[model samples]
Target: MKCYLVPCVAGFIAFNENLDIVDYELFPRRSIISKLLEFEKGLTAEEEKIIKRLLKDYGKISIESVHRWKYGKFKGVILESPNIGGEYLRENLREILKEIGFIKDGEFQEIIYEIHMGMTIKRLEESFREQDKLIIQAVSTLDDLDESIGKFVERIREWYSIYFPELESVKDHEHYVKLITEHPRREDIIKLKKLPRESMGAELEEEDIEIIREFARAIRSLQLLRKSIEGYIESKMGYLAPNLRDVAGTTLGAKLIAHAGSMKKLALLPSSTIQVMGAEKALFRHLRRGSKPPKHGLIYQHPLVRGSNWRVRGKIARVLASKISLAVRKDVFTGEYDPNIKEDLYKRVSIIREKPKKKGKKRR
Candidate 1:
């Protein structure tokens, strides 16, 4: 009752509690209560945890004060005065106020009223005109914002196309979308300053800005680290030269060895065998040297060592020698069968030699 209907205004006249109607103050209890509580400007992690725990335990605990933390809400005080009287009182007050004005009387009274009312009517009409102008300006500003946003999106698409040329078709949209999500351009723009101008010109297009903007929404996403990608590409290029040389060498070796016999013969032949048999070192050296070396060394790499039982390794070497000799003579070892050589060998053997001569007579 003291807070609600106490003669606070009259108290200044009766009691000298340093009070006067001239100095009457509105001592807001709510403000005082809020001040009494330990309020802080910012929350520490511990405080945040406490708040979250309270919220979790209580289901939902609203601190009406904290609603201002959002983008548009925090602008002003939200003093929630109750609407118990409803809107009826406000409408009645407006109608009564409207009726208190001068009436539209006849002749002299009307003329006098018009003379007085002209300026007020003109002022109100001018206010409405100003409102209309403001509305138009607002619409123009909104249109500009929309156009800017559209251009930003177009630029992002164009930039994406430039960077990832493989996505020229609709089929590549999935890959392009993935790339945009993975490496957005908006976050990248800031990091772009770190990259060389030439590199940016070579890679980024207008579309990247939109992509980056979209990616930038993820606060933790590092769209700005454009140099990292460049560094990776540059690093990869450094090893490309040596890898290409190795690939070429391996391919040439395969072709040459395949024409000679098969990979098995090539593997068994040693470098020592190739060298002793005078095989072309240029054709096999790149493969033989360094980490791989020659698996099969010198002997069996020669073709003549096939029948030699000096030792398994020695026979291999002899075969290698024959191959090398054949390669030198005909550029490749044909190992073609000759009937004359077979007949001569049969003639030399006692049992088979006689049978072949008798068979030859029967054929004649």
Candidate 2:
């Protein structure tokens, strides 16, 4: 099997150029509220109907997410058609807003801010537990990898706590070494001790045995999860964007949204591209300005560079892009794309583009 290693220079150059495209050459935004106000004064009855519909379904818009959408802080804003139960729900919702002092004079900003703050507080309180669970789940998912690696890391930490009080934790290097020797699989240690020059045991102190055991356990755990953890981190980062691991560590999670592209393309994208996608303001700017899009996110993952020897990679990219474009057009990410999608699209493109048979043309 062959693997393509992304050249450091290529990734860096692509990233810097991408940053320039986003940071300096994006378009301006026009406010929807301002547009609405203009329409309020001059709108026709049909326009009025649409405005009422928007008002009716306003609750579906998350207050904070909407605020971001309004300010053009988010990349996409998809609105579903309003349903029948509008007025009754709005009236009851208005009453609740009034009780909370958010309806009178209609302090939309204040209400949004309050909801955002509430969510933030809730998330902060839950983060530690969430992270611990993620760690365990990540460890368990690596079935093909060695399980001893995880056990080793755990035992190392445990032994450090047992022996070294001042260090207070097994995370240190000294503690790791101490733990490894202490629990050096007894059979292996005995064989080593029987040698003429003898093993390192003569130099090891009594406290070191437990510490060495703990160290070995820690190393073993790490070994078990090494490859899977790399894949896990890649998958994890895809949830946000690429390149975040280097910047944000393992805590904050990936920042990109689902529309950026599918997980496969995202995993293949360079970090710079991911960051560019996350810069919603710039991306939306290009899109709204009717210019060539900065890149519809993972669409760039298609191997269509202007100059590249890897024609095969480009073909693969085109196929992937075509599928992704179809997914996006159908709003499949939102679960609205066809369920029997395979049957629906069978040779659809080929059928449409196939050339007609010519007169007197012989069958090849």
Task: Pick the lDDT winner.
Answer: 2
| TM-score of each candidate structure, all chains considered together | 0.15, 0.24
Prediction-by-prediction clash tally: 41, 24
What is the model-wide C-alpha lDDT for candidate 2?
0.36
lDDT of every model, 2 decimals: 0.32, 0.36
Q: lDDT by residue for model 2 over 95-156, one digit each (tens)?
A: 43344343474453344334433332333234453332343334333332345444545555
**Could you give candidate 1's per-residue lDDT for residues 247-323 as a string of tens digits?**
11222222334333433353355534443432445436755664433223323332233233333434344333333
lDDT for model 1 comes to: 0.32
Which segments of model 2 are wrong by more than 4 Å?
A: 1-203, 216-309, 328-364
- Candidate 1 — which residues are off by over 4 angstroms? 1-130, 166-364
